[model samples]
Target: MKTKNIIFIYILLLSFSFAQSALKIATVSYIKGSCYIENSIQDKSITPLAGNSIMNNDIIHSKEDSFCDIIFDDDATKIHIDENTRVKILSDNYSRVFEVYYGSVFVSNAKTHIKTYIQTLNNNIYVNNNNIWVNSYRDFDKVVSINYNANIYNYISNSQIILKPLTAYNIFSNGSVKIDNNLDLVPDYIEDESYLQVRKENRNKYDVYLNDYDLIPVYGRETEKRSFDDNGFKLGLTAGTRYMNNNEYLTFGLFPQYKHNNFIVYSKLNVYYDYFLKCSSFDDCEFTESGIYSNWESKNDILEKFHLRYHRSDYNNSFSIYAGEIPQVTFGHGYLVNKFSNYYEYPLRSDFGVNIDWKIDNDFLNFKFLVPSIREYFRDGGIFGMHASLFLSHRFPLTLGLGFVMDFNQFSQSPRVYDVDSSIDSRQIKAFELDFELDIIRSMNLDVSIYGELVGIWYPENIFYFRSDGLMPFSDDLRWRRGTWGVMAPGVSLLIDNKHEINFAFNFNSAAFYPSYFNTNYLYNRSLYYLTAQPFDFNTLGFNLVGNQIGMLNDFAINSTNMEFFVPKELYPILTNKINVFPLRGFSIDYKYNFRNKIEYYNAISVYTQNVGQEKIKSQTYYTFDAKLSIKENILRNLSSLNFYVSNVFFLERDDREEYTFGFNMMFDLPSDVYILFDIGQVFYDVSLNGKRNNVLNSGLQLRLNF
Candidate 1:
C-alpha cells in the first residue's frame, strides 16, 4: 500500500510539471493582410505567426483590411480583431486584462468560470465566460454580446450595466449611453462568409507557418502598423487673393506628398500674380516687389520646396536622413546658427542641405551641411555644423558643439535695405557653444525648466580693423587684430498646465563681441547692438533683459535694454577732439487678453533713447503705443467662423502720427475636405505731406484642399 501511494504522488508531480511547461498566455491562431506584435519588454516588434506565443505587455496591431485571431491557452477563449486596431495586454495571468484602443474586436469564452476584461478610454467590460463584440471610433463606441452575458462600467459617470446576451449597447464619448435588444442582421462583429472563404484558401499557408516555420510569421508587413499614406500619395492646394496698401495680388500654392515604407517625398510650390490682370510677367507685378507677401514669390511658374527623407525606427533606436531643399531649423539655444527666416523675408530665404540624425539610448548625434546659394557655390558661403547631446538624467541634458561658416563675400554686398554695410574683407568664422538644460520642477499641474548657453566666435582680424586714409591706405596703429569674445544667456520658464506660462531671459555680451559680424541674440531677433551701434563701430558691455507671461486671461511681454558703458571713439568729423561714446537704452511692453470665448484685447508700449557720438551732446528718444481689440463667433457647427478686429497706434511725440485699422475675417469649413477663409480691412495711416490722412484697403481670400 505504501509503494502504490508513492507511485501515485510521483505521477501527479510529473503531470503538474508537464501542464506548467505547456501553459502559454495566448496563441496567434490566424492573421490576414498585415499584422505585428510589439513587445514592451524588448522594445521591438516581431512578426507573429499562427501558434506563436503571446506574452505579457504585448501590443497587437492590424493594418487596414487586415484581421487577426488570438486564442488563449488557459481557457481556449478566442479574440477576432478587425482592420486598423490596436490591442495591448496589461495582465495575462489568471484573469486577463486587455485594452482595445481603436477599431473593433470580438471576444468569446464558451465555457463557464472563464474570465476576461477589456478596457476602453471611458468604460470597462468584464466577461464572465461570455462572448462580446466591441467597436470603438473617434468619439463613439458600440458593443454587442451574443449567446452570453457581460458586465460594463462607465468610468466617467460611475454607472454600471449588466449586458444581457443578444443585446446591443451604444456608448458616446460625451457620457451618454443606450442599449437595445434588436440586433442588425449583418452586424460588423460576426465574421462574414467572405473572410471565412479566404481563411479556407489560406489554410495550407497557415499550417506551414505553424508547423514548418515554427510559428514564425512571414515578413510581409514592413512596419508594426500602416501609415496614413503608406505606399501612397497625397496632394494639397492653396489659392488666395490679397490686397494690401491698395495693392492687390492673387496667390496659388500646391503641396504634394508621397510615402513608401520608411521613405517620404514632399514639395510646396506657390505662385503669385497681379490682380489687375495686366502684368504679363510674374516679376513685373507690383505686388511681387512689395516684400509684404512672404509666403512665396513666383520665379518662373512658382516656388518649389522639394525634400527627400528616410526615417526608420527599431529597437529603441532611430535614424533619419534628409536631403534637398531642407529648412534650416536649429534647436537647443541657437548659439551658433539661426534660421535665415529670423532675419530676412521667407521668400528670399533659401537653404539646400543634407541633414542626418541618429539617436540611441540617451545620446543623439546630428549633422548639417547647407548651401545658402546654389549659383554662387561654396564661395557664396554656407554653414557646416555638427552637434551632440546626452541626457545625464531624465530632466537634465548637456550639450556642446562647433560650427563654421564659410564666407568669402561677407563684406561685398551692395548697400541695400536691411544691410549691415561692413567693409571688412572676406572672413570665415568658427564658433563654439555649450549649453546646460535643466528641468527644475515637474508636477501634475506645473512644470519649470531653465536653459543657459555660452558661445564664442573666432576669426582672422576679427577686431580693430585698419582705418584707411586713402593716400596711405592703412594706419599701422589701427591694424586688424585677431580676437575672440563670448555672449552668455540664461533663461528660465515656468508652466502651469498648457494654458499659462512665463519666461525670462537675460543676455550679456562682452565688450569685444561685435554684433554686426556675429549676429548674436539670434534667438530673439532683438539684436540691440547691431540695430543701434553696428554702423558706428561702437562696442558694448551691457545686458538685455526679456520676459513673457501667458495666463488664462492675458498674455504679456517686456523687453528692456541698457548699454550703460561703451567703448569711446571719435565721430568721423564731429567729435575728434573730445572722447566720443554712444549710450543705448530702451524698454517695451505688450499685453494681450483672451476672454476664451469671443473677445480679445491687446496693448503695446515702447520707449527708447539712443545716444550717438558724445552722449550729452547728441541724443534722441522715441515712444510708441498701440492697442487692438478682436471679436469672433462660430458661424456653423465646426464648419465656419467669423471675426472682427480694430486696432490703433499712437506716436506720443509726433503730431498726426496716429494710425487706425479695422478688419473682418471669415473662415469656412463646410466641405469636409477643404477650407475657405476671407479677410477684409481698412487701414488709416498717418497724415500725408498734403495734410490729408491716407487710407488703404486690405483684403485676402484663401482656399485650401487636401486629398
Candidate 2:
C-alpha cells in the first residue's frame, strides 16, 4: 500500500507538469485560403482548421492568396498573418513573442499590461502601442506603427531605435535604415477589406478589451482608400527633340502599362524623325532620309517592345519569366559570358529576347535560361544558353553548377563578308564551363565564398596561322585544329552587409582563349576578325633587339633595306579584380582591372632562324571605372531628380587611345501631372585609328504627361 501511494503521487506530479508544458498560448480564429501549422517537436506540417490550438514553439505558415487571424490566450492581443508569411510562436513567463522569419504580420495589442515582442532576422521589435505591422524579407526588414509607438533593436549593429506612430522604418541587411513619415505608401495588403473585417469579427467574438488611444485621422484613411481605387490603367506620353552632332531630330514615344496580381504587360512605341527630312507634302518627302519612314523596312522595328512578365513566389518556390527586351544577362560566375545585352543599340536596332528563372527552397536548386535574339534565331542563327546550380546540403552547403552557351553561326551577323572560303566551314562557336563554390563564412552582416571554374571554347574550323614564305607571309595549310581552354582558380568573393561586394580571381588561358569572351561589347566586336585578318609575312620575322622596335628598325635599315616587325602570341597568367560599392540609396560605383601578359620576339639576327629570337614578356593592364548618381526622392522644391553617369576605360597596351563617356539627365515635376526632362551625353573615340579623335555630342529635351 505504501509503494502504490508513492507511485500514484509521482505519476500525478508528472501529469501536472506535462499539462503546464503543453499549455495553449494562442488559437487560430479565422482562416481565408490554405493555412498550415508546423509541429516543432515532430517536424511535420498539417492544415490548420478553425480554432486550432497554437502552442509554444509552433510555426504557422500562410500560403499564397491566403491570410489568417490568431487570437492569443490573453484575448486582448491578436495578430493577422498575411499571404506568404511564416511565423513562430514563443511563450515565456514574462511575455509572448512572435518570430517572423519572412513576410508580414499585423499585431494589435489592446492591453497595456501584456508585453508583446516581434523578432525578425535582424531586428527585435517591442510593441508598446496598440497597433503595428512588421515585415521581414530576404534583403531587409520593415516596421510600421499604425496607432502607437515601438522600440526596435538591431542585431547586426547592436543599436536601438524608436518607431513613432504613423511612421514606417526600413532596415536593410547592410545595417542601413530608412524612415518614411507617410503611411499612405504602405503595402496594399495591410488595408485589405477582408483582413480588416476578419480582425474586427475575431475581436468582437473573443470579447477583447481596448484602452483608449489616439485614432487615425479620417482624411488619411480617405486618401488611402482613394489611392487604391484610382489604380486602374496608366498611360504616359513623351515628346522630345534631340540634337546630335549638327543634326536635329524629333522623338515621340508612348508608354502603356497594366498590372494585375502577378501578371504584367507593358509596351513602348517610339518614333524618330529627322528635322531635315520633313517636307510640306507627303509626296515630296524622301523616305530614305527619314528615320521614322525607313524603320518600316525591317520587321524588328515593329516589335520594339511588347513586353510580358509573370512572377510567382511561394514559401519555398519562385518562378519568373520575361519576354521581349532583356537588358542584361549573365550565367554562372560569368566565365564565358557576362552582362550580355540585346539592347545595346536601343534606337538604332533592337532584338526580341526571352529569359526565365526558377529557384527552389532557398537556392537549393536554381535554374536560368536565356535567348538573346528570338527573331534572329528563326531567320539566321542566334545566341542561347542555360545555367543550373544545385546545393547539396542546407548547412555548410557545397554548390556545383554547369553552364553552356552556343552561337549557332558566328558569321550570321554578316554572312556576305565571312563566306569567303568554302573549305573553311563550321562557323559555330560553343563554350562549356564547370564551376564550384563553397561558403567559408555566412553571417547576418558578412558573407565570404570561395569559387573556381574550368571552361573550354571550341571552334570546328581549323586555326588560321600566318607563316613566312620567302619575302612575304602566306596562310599556312589548314592542319592545326584545336580548342582553347582556360581556368579561373582560387577566386574569392566578399559581400559585406549587402552594401559592398568585392571579387578577386587568378585567370590562366591558352594561346587563343580569353576570359569573358562574350561580354558587353561582343555585339560590335564579333565581326572584327574579318577586317584584321592578314597573311603572315615570313620575311618580316626576326629576333629580339636591344632597344625598342623602332630603334631596332633603324638599325635594320642601316644594315639592310628590308625591315622586320615583332609579332606576339597572347599567353596568360592573368589577374582580375572587381569591386562594387553602394554607399547610399541612389549612388553606386563599379571598377574592374585585368592584368595580362603577351609574348613578343625581338630581332637579334640578320636572317630568320628556327628559334634564335630573343623572347620577351610584356604586361598590358586594362582598367575601367564607372560611377552613377541618381536622386529620386524630393530634395528640392519641384526638382524631381538629377541623374548623371561617367565611364572611362584605359586599354593600356591594347589600344593607343583612351575612351571616355559622360551623360547627364534631369527631371522636373510641373503642375497638372506634367514633367519636363533634359538629357545630354558625349562619347570620344578614334574610329579610324588616326591621330585625330572624334567627339559625338547628343542632347535632348522632352515633356512627359501621365494619365
Best by lDDT: 2
Q: What tens-digit string does per-residue lDDT give for candidate 1 at 240-339? A: 8776534577778788999887898987676656545446697765423543444343441132266678976432356777765545455345534433
Kindly report which residue stretches of model 2 are placed more than 4 angstroms away from their true locations once superposed: 1-231, 243-247, 277-293, 415-426, 464-481, 529-614, 617-671, 678-700
Among the numbered candidates, top TM-score falls to 2
What C-alpha lDDT do the candidate models reach, one value each? 0.49, 0.58
lDDT score at residue 82, model 2, on the 0-100 scale: 90
Compute each candidate's TM-score over C-alphas. 0.42, 0.56
Q: Where does candidate 1 stray beyond 4 Å?
A: 1-231, 242-248, 252-254, 275-305, 309-315, 320-328, 335-357, 363-379, 393-408, 411-427, 439-450, 459-484, 489-501, 512-668, 677-700
